[model samples]
Target chain A: MKDLDGLDLPTFEDVIAAHARIAPHIRRTPVLVSEALNALTGAELFFKCENFQEAGAFKVRGACNAVFGLDDEQAKLGVATHSSGNHALSLSYAAGRRGIPCTVVMPRTAPQAKKDAVIGYGGRIVECEPSTSSREATFARVQEETGAEFVHPYNDPRVIAGQGTCSRELAEQVEGLDAVIAPIGGGGMISGCCLTLSTIAPHIKIYAAEPEQADDAYRSFKAGHIIADDAPDTIADGLKVPLKDRTWHFVSNHVTDILTCSEQEIIDAMKLTFKRLRVVMEPSCAPPLAAILKNPEVFRGKRVGVIITGGNVDLDRLPWIKG
Target chain B: MKDLDGLDLPTFEDVIAAHARIAPHIRRTPVLVSEALNALTGAELFFKCENFQEAGAFKVRGACNAVFGLDDEQAKLGVATHSSGNHALSLSYAAGRRGIPCTVVMPRTAPQAKKDAVIGYGGRIVECEPSTSSREATFARVQEETGAEFVHPYNDPRVIAGQGTCSRELAEQVEGLDAVIAPIGGGGMISGCCLTLSTIAPHIKIYAAEPEQADDAYRSFKAGHIIADDAPDTIADGLKVPLKDRTWHFVSNHVTDILTCSEQEIIDAMKLTFKRLRVVMEPSCAPPLAAILKNPEVFRGKRVGVIITGGNVDLDRLPWIKG
Candidate 1:
């Protein structure tokens, strides 16, 4: 609940430190420049293809940093977290690499691909009903039973620092970006991107693209208060989280704007990404592209960076019309 | 039908030259190493991801090389070819870049995605019934009508020279690969690979994988005579071609073996590739993985190179499961 001001805010140095610490454990996923996309949007776009990252998402950076940054005793106790999909897979992969035990509390509705990925990486899963209350109760039970350290998916400072490593690499890879747009789920990735951009390239603007159906963060950003949605319905299951107090502070201070895209637009962009870029991206990952495609005038002729957050779409339930 | 023995084969120098010619026009797709795959298959696997190559296939290498290799007068006439899918898209993309006219004779059964890609890149499509006889007849009519130069998808020397550039880049990327395995359709890619390896590293064994249902190339290699299957049925639609005379000669002289995998094994391998590698591969592209999984003892402890040739899978009619 502490405000992310003088004492709580992460400096550029902290993000740089996080980058160095997680460098060995995480991959520097390639930044692909799409001529097709740029020509369509009229914006010179650079896609930071984090979908190609280990565990098929950017969560590995933060998860690896959080688990490895722990003290020896804390590391011995191992780490526990709750996630819909990407975070669990990343935490499981990172923890597995360090030979530490990991337990992930996931919604039973989470995609089978993600659950398989988490299990494949040797993580124990505790499934709960698809509700926030159920998730919290299950997490509490698991934490008490194992006496493990909880690495909050987005709210914790360590996770934020780890996530910031993505933007650090982006800033190092491409210079003079006018802005960076990242899809927001629990605010972990965007918070990290903001922190890194603020330190490394303070002039570069950072934006968050939220699904219209799950626009809690966008509403909260405009209202200057934390917003919680009772039951959001959107294809981007990843971006269904309500804003947390810690994430609200970071999001309010660091992010330039929180934009919303329609579910249909997200689906169209997802299809374009798969067909043209030949990369599998879930609906949440398409928000940045959606924003650029819908509001080309706002981003035209500017050097825009977009993060393809993940590629864990279920083949059977693909949102786009196939063949 | 001219004997390839008297006709000079492309040397590694020729491949290297072709690479320089196409380098500016093509992408150097990533070479991904999978520790998990290596552990599962007992082989050090280096996957040259040509699925991520320009136009979503390695066919672009040959298409670009042939297009650019043409004399000014010949190029003025433009080019024409017949393909099931990937080759049409590649040729369209290459021709579009060169500002030249291109005519593609595609089977009516080809996936809509492939047709869209070809059209999107400004190629004129001439649909033919799904058979070798119909395709050849349609292509001949188009060639005669347009007075366009013919670029045979597999049989042309220029096209083979272009495809060789993939192995040239692969050899440079991964050092000391003991062998290279690629799926054999018309034997264009394998012929090119063989031509490159024979001149650069003659000791590096080359293997061709063919689906058991469409094992004409495999039988041809064993019998010391070019074999043709009048009717072949397999999940690997890309490997349905009967070997061409030129390619058969190269396979007989240079390739160490032509391995066969079951349709079920190919589907399983395709699913594994998507799950573990986060890459969408068609059944033909998964043949090397099937070979490694089915015959682990053959590749155990050896540095094996697998060319993921293309990723033009039809999501609607996925070879593995009906959606």
Candidate 2:
């Protein structure tokens, strides 16, 4: 099945196929439930701990699917992306495992640690200006020169199908979830959740959690169209990207609600999660708990599945522990 | 089985009974392994994650056993302990769950966060001096006045039996571990490991790790007697206590070796574990990794089980983040 945007939207079958293809590469992250967190939120919360996934995020699932699904000819050309975070690292990780080249077009201002991570995973870096136009232009040039297939961080069908495996596994691991919540950046993970749940467990409501400081997805949902943002500064750095065509399809078609929480609320939720759950995650992943805390009425008695999207964090730069 | 001190040392049968008795009260924490950490150490390290235990430590197992194992009349008097860390919080947690009054005699200099945790868990705090003499004196007065049962942190047989359940679970979780290493504080966890492994998996080596700043366990192990220290200081605050008689018997008889690591080495190992495992563990839990890293030859090519003792830390005071 293809969306109206002419992109091939992978079905539940495709997600199943992706899971089988990438099962050997990606991690089957455990579902951790904390009685303390459940008591605090007044909800039965099941945390899908993708923070323990390879490359430290669920993106590795999609990256592995895309890399491993490629035919020999296409695989020889390799994979490329414009992400500066976990996606880039994951793609690099996947491509390295397959013995193929991976190129990352990152802004020159990207953190040195992230750059080193990409390099550590055998990724070639193509530095661009700190702007979307510059990033796209550089990515185009790199793809053209290297003949590398461009994998949009969230918009590709294979990537979406790969991410959908998380929810499929969640359904098998946990029974009778009233709703599922995942952070919406470019809407990849939430889209994957929607794709999986809408087909396998259609009774389950799908919710999108977004940082209020970078509320592009929230605003887009209300406006009934896509709202593209260039460079919004938020502590949830992974969530600054705007919704693209493929993700907008899932959000518009299946999502029940889009919730937003303030930056302070997200940080508080992150700390509370660490204290209660004993798991370290990036700020972008805390928006689900933030939304739950802010609008408890929406989720008060529900058995909610929260996808902890990632755990890549700078230990020296905790938001609460200020310099 | 009773020891020379007339303490009825709980046998492997008692550990099995304790597991059945305390199963409902405590969490069966998951065993997590990090391939990154394994690669770094050149050993297959299975981390028995007690940090995720209720009340945020493995001490909850013993605390729950002691609190719940009591008969009705004895339970009416409640429980009391003289400690300033995980033991206090865990005992308070257990007591709170069982609807019993618990008293803790803590040093006046203990961190406010730890004190708050005990109070939050419904424990009454009696402030004492920093020395063991002052602590014991204050605890004696409190126990005499309240008629509460004195559940000595590591000296009691029930406590050792309670902790022994961790190694029992580890033995079931992972097969063919060449050795097991746990941080030695007052030697509760190590003694428990010794008690369990020495009985069932007698071939497996038992190693006790200690911080160099608080090397009473190391010194005592070599001296062939209990060497009580008065308020040793280390970043691993949970391990500052000295060895007691009940723990000394197990350590002197069953332990294969006692290893020590410097303060900075412990902090570095803690940071590395956080980075690689994405689990927030306390400094007291890092000595095993420090020992592994400092002496790779001792652990390389072997399958080792490292017990993560706790995760209760003052997040505001992370060592890597300079003030």
Candidate 3:
């Protein structure tokens, strides 16, 4: 843990500055409550809807903060990221807003719709083999070739600080929240919640929900150290990545517990969310709600804030329907 | 025109009263704007999201007003209605809220999901043949037996007043809107918009959108009279019903025009709304957006308010997907 001392971990003040930096580009996304979901969970739940974000995810908040915070010289070189999902689209959107170039290093095998969306947002694509080493190698090459700032999807301090803005808004929107939960992958969003709520609303307990198939964060929490998983698969594809040092610092210290749910539970929770909340969100956003529904005793009678992280999904292949 | 002298029409004052009366029951549904949509349509569109209403449709506003407006004696008998769609579900919801019995006379062939939802809201369903005459006869018999006060879905003054509150909210939520558009489905929502906008902001033009497959309202507006259609088939099933006298009174007088789009256009607009707005609205909500897209010259450089009327749809049968 002492190794973190030299790393520039973001503080609450950084979160405040990040909020100010990205306020113009990001939405103060609405908080929605459902009587039916409340009755079913035995908890009063407040859903912070980042799905309605212009870039269709909470990732845009971090992307905008990173893009807009760049000084004139750095901004001229532009920003780059390796992602096949919302992060790619969000970063492209943010860079486009600042009139800077965005280069995405994505797998050559990625869906055409996703590639088209990134290009639609004015991002240049650099194709890579669909593997961890290949993606990292391609990303490094792209950064070296272009001298562009590499924006890690969730690991960067700036990204965590920007993500903290969501919980800050959630706390302001809903008073007396006894707990807050979010789906955790690389822990950018959870780290942000930890950073913000620990400073401003320490009484509120923070929890991270993960897909059972990709429960490295849960294992890490139990073993009192970081646990890395290689290519663990789950329908909640956004959560397949491993947590890094900067995110691990917040997850270890502030998060009260890490919870996991089965894939079927996630799908059920997703369908229920669509039916009850009447919002279209992706699979990654379902784990928190699934955890709550699966272990109602943990959330019962508490005022809980659930982060619906993103809404980017293929409408044709909704998970609940048979292929 | 003189025939309307004896008919009771809801006024702006009634809209105010209805707002106050149903304020506790209904949400001040948020207005959403999409920059992507704006870029495509060339209009600054403000979407009034009644789809986010607790009962999943704007019909809840009207239903709540009717159910809550009943006096103690009338409440004792409860409420009755004949509908095969949102009104049946909405009235059931409102009646359940009021702790009153709700009897719905629905077609025997209506989807089981629809029937289950109505029953879930504590409504009693009396099924009849899936025809206008059989539905009316069944409704008449049920009303006679139960002594429940009948609530006409769109043609009643109370319902019109309740629906007007949606536009009242929109008018307050947005500034300097040049025009407001909503799909014409028996004209309940559009009539309500006309009622509220005519009194509060008459300068704002009111446009009704209709599917070409069931363009009776458009024909009626052009013909300068009410034109009733019998059992027209369209993907926008909600708009197949013809406008009644009460709604026609508003459409013939206050509505600026009724625009029509083909069935394919409606389906395309529905997909675009889901993709751009990240919302789960039904096909009935698509016509207004379709009309706007098809006639871009009409809405370009204008601030347009689009009423997304409902979100209740079968996920398995999305219009854009091949069956």
Q: List the global CA lDDT of all models.
A: 0.84, 0.91, 0.93
In CAPRI terms, model 1 is classed as acceptable
lDDT tens per residue, model 1, B129-203: 987799889988998898888877888777788899888889999999999999999999999998888988898
User: What is the C-alpha lDDT profile of model 2 across B177-223, one tens digit per residue?
Assistant: 99999999899999999989999999999998999999999999898
Of the candidates numbered 1 and 2, which has the greater DockQ value?
2
Better of 1 and 3 by DockQ: 3
Task: List residue ranges in candidate 3 displaced over 4 A.
Answer: A1-3, B1-3
Give fnat for candidate 2: 0.62
lDDT of 2 at A320: 90
lDDT of 3 at A210: 99
- Model 2's CAPRI class is medium
DockQ of each: 0.33, 0.76, 0.64
Clashes of each: 0, 0, 0
Q: Compared to the true structure, candidate 3 yields what TM-score?
A: 0.98
The numbered model that scores best in lDDT is 3
TM-score of each: 0.92, 0.97, 0.98
Residue-level lDDT tens digits of model 2 in A1-323 = 55555677888888999999999988889888888788878999999999999989999988988999999999999999998989999999999999999999999999999999899889999999988799989999999998998887889999999999999999999999999999999988988998999999999999989988899999999999999876777889889989988889899999999999889999999998888888999998999999998888998999999999999999889999986
Runs of candidate 1 exceeding 4 Å displacement: A1-7, A107-116, A126-138, A141-145, A321-323, B1-4, B107-113, B127-138
